[model samples]
Target: MTISSTPEGVSVQPRHIRFDVSDDLKSFWHGNNAFRTAFFNALSLQFPDGEQQFINAVRLYRDRIEDPKLQAEIRGFIGQEALHSREHKSYNEALKARGYDIDAIDERFARHMKWVANLPPSRQLAGTCGAEHYTAVLANAILRHPEWMEGATPAMACLWRWHAIEETEHKSVAFDVYRECVGDERLRRIVFLFVTWNFFKYTFLNTCSLLKTDGKLWSVKTWLGGLNFLWGKPGVIRKCLPDFLAYFRKGFHPWQHDNRRLLEKNLKELEAAPSAH
Candidate 1:
């Protein structure tokens, strides 16, 4: 968690951290809560390919960025996301080993990204910007609220906490690239609208499929508990509403919300602790 000032002076240092996602990890890794666990598992299914899409989208404009610091941040962003894809791939494989169809979920996203690739580069990058904003806000929620990961196995917990810190570290890299290469504010906002709806739509489908596959979809109590986790007291989606809405402002930057306090506090906690045994 050491922060190094690069030659360009941006604080983005890609820490090549690794975690031990052992085969012993259960399918319902979140304290046996199938719905909660499937929600995170569904997210893991997206990272391997989704992260590569982020890298490719930003790399599209790598040659055009004139700012030295932003360039350095882009490199860091790519490196961090690459490791994230690798680690999440390993995590997904572990779930697949536990007899879940996570590979199908992973492939579904890959195919979807392939279709997205056919769009104009600006639109593709705008899609990446939209997704990055989601990750940044979601990461902020995890860091701000320890309860989100409260009952996970140590390895899964370490993996997510590490991802959240790095996501926050380089959250603005793709957006900056989009603004640099294609400063189409209207398109950016429009793409976000499309991406947001599609994101939640896919998330719900994937999560419900996972839940149904695991037999939790039939349980009224499971549905109630899951709903409470997402929309009840300390509701993460509710808490993130302001930040989410802030994205539509004519001129919006991720740092304007300024969750660095949470980042610093969590970074120290992570560095002070050992990885999952």
Candidate 2:
């Protein structure tokens, strides 16, 4: 399949905004709901090392990409992901300071990523592309529906939305790079299946670990509520299934599921709320 370009009007620019996620940050910051808060915290824990993996995977093909525009996007992708890693590192530190065993969780992910680092460069890039699609799908949902952040702490809300906006903007960078360098559709599809499995496995395990630390792991009410939130009304993951599955299509491209309007609207809102960042 041919490489699909990032859509016009979508700019992969980095927003160097620092969030105030300090020690005083509440453990149940999402509407005082342990499940929701733990769910998001679980994601933050993965970003630092995960973002670096993405950066490294894309950088493998940097010199081979002769197109000036794609090269510029590579720089932008690396910059945005680097800043993401920094902010999430600080965010995760706050979680650790709050007495959660985030170090263990972080180390677990770090170990898995180390294994990924040893894979063939093309496989690594394919994994990056798969992970990017996952983020882009969830990012689009968060941007399209404001209620996802309804009860989140202001700073946390802004940080996540900013992340969502940028994820939407640069969703196609790694995919483009992979297409240009490898263009192995079968490999991309197969790797995406594995990525999907690990994504859910680790996210669930990490969320459970955080909840257990909070003494909410055995709370049936917490499990029921969190399960409902993800699979019942509003069904965030359920809603994303179609978009996630699209990656397996023969000629699929990240830009094919364009949501630039959502990106533009959320960006304007984010810019207006400078203090939120």
Candidate 3:
């Protein structure tokens, strides 16, 4: 992927750090861990290919990247994304083993990506960046909403928790990369924010729909539990949203949150816990 902005201008480089997921929380799904299993299965099927497309979109001008620093950052970004997709693939297998409708989920998910990939560059950038905003927000919310995972099914909790940690950790890389690569900041922000709010609404609402479809809807215990655990907690939004919106401001940095502490804490615990089959 080519980054128009170099360190001479701007770009996203790789940072080494794996997120820690709590063993206790691994099993926590909204209701049934299998519901989450299915969701993940779907996500894994969609992401790698979609990521390639997104990468290709950036590659549209790979040779144009004149800045060595920015080029390295782009390589790092791609490497991390590749790692993420591979790890998720392993996780998705666990979901299928747990009896998720992985095939069905993948079929539909592939269709969506196909549609997304067909969109114009402007729209594609918006969707990708917008989705990043949601992930970034949700990631921070997960860390702040520790209580939300308190009683979740262990496997499911671990999955989302690990993903959240990584997302939060890498939150700004894509946006910053995009800003450095693409056109006017003002236009990017407008499209970015617009895609963001809409994607968020779609994701949560769709998650609800999926839960119901999978017969996990009545898991109100999990539902309300997640809410109270995450958004319901004091300072949940404060800890997260400001970071998200702060993107509009100069000198905003996701690293300021330093979620690695939480990841490390969880990893030690996972290391001690028995692995789930």
Best by lDDT: 2
What overall lDDT goes with each candidate model? 0.81, 0.89, 0.54
Location of the lowest summed lDDT over 10 successive residues in candidate 3: 4-13
Q: Kindly list the per-residue Cα lDDT of model 3 for residues 149-221, writing each as its tens digit.
A: 5545655565555566555544555555555656456656676676656445444544555565567777876
The alpha-carbon RMSD values of the candidates against the true structure, listed in the order shown, are 3.5, 1.6, 5.9
TM-score of each: 0.93, 0.97, 0.64
Better of 1 and 2 by TM-score: 2
lDDT of 1 by residue, 1-277 (tens): 2122222323677777778775435657788888788888888788888899888888888998777777778888999999999988888787777777876776777788898888888999999999999999999999888888888877777778889989988888888788777989999999999889978877887888788778788899998888888889657678888888889998898777777778888888888768822
| Clash pairs detected, candidate 2 | none
Ranking by TM-score: 2, 1, 3
- Let me know the TM-score candidate 3 reaches against the reference structure: 0.64
Residue 121, model 3: lDDT of 67
* TM-score-best of 2 and 3: 2
Worst 10 residues of 2 by lDDT: 20-29
- Deviating ranges (above 4 Å) for candidate 1: 1-10
How much lDDT does candidate 3 score?
Answer: 0.54
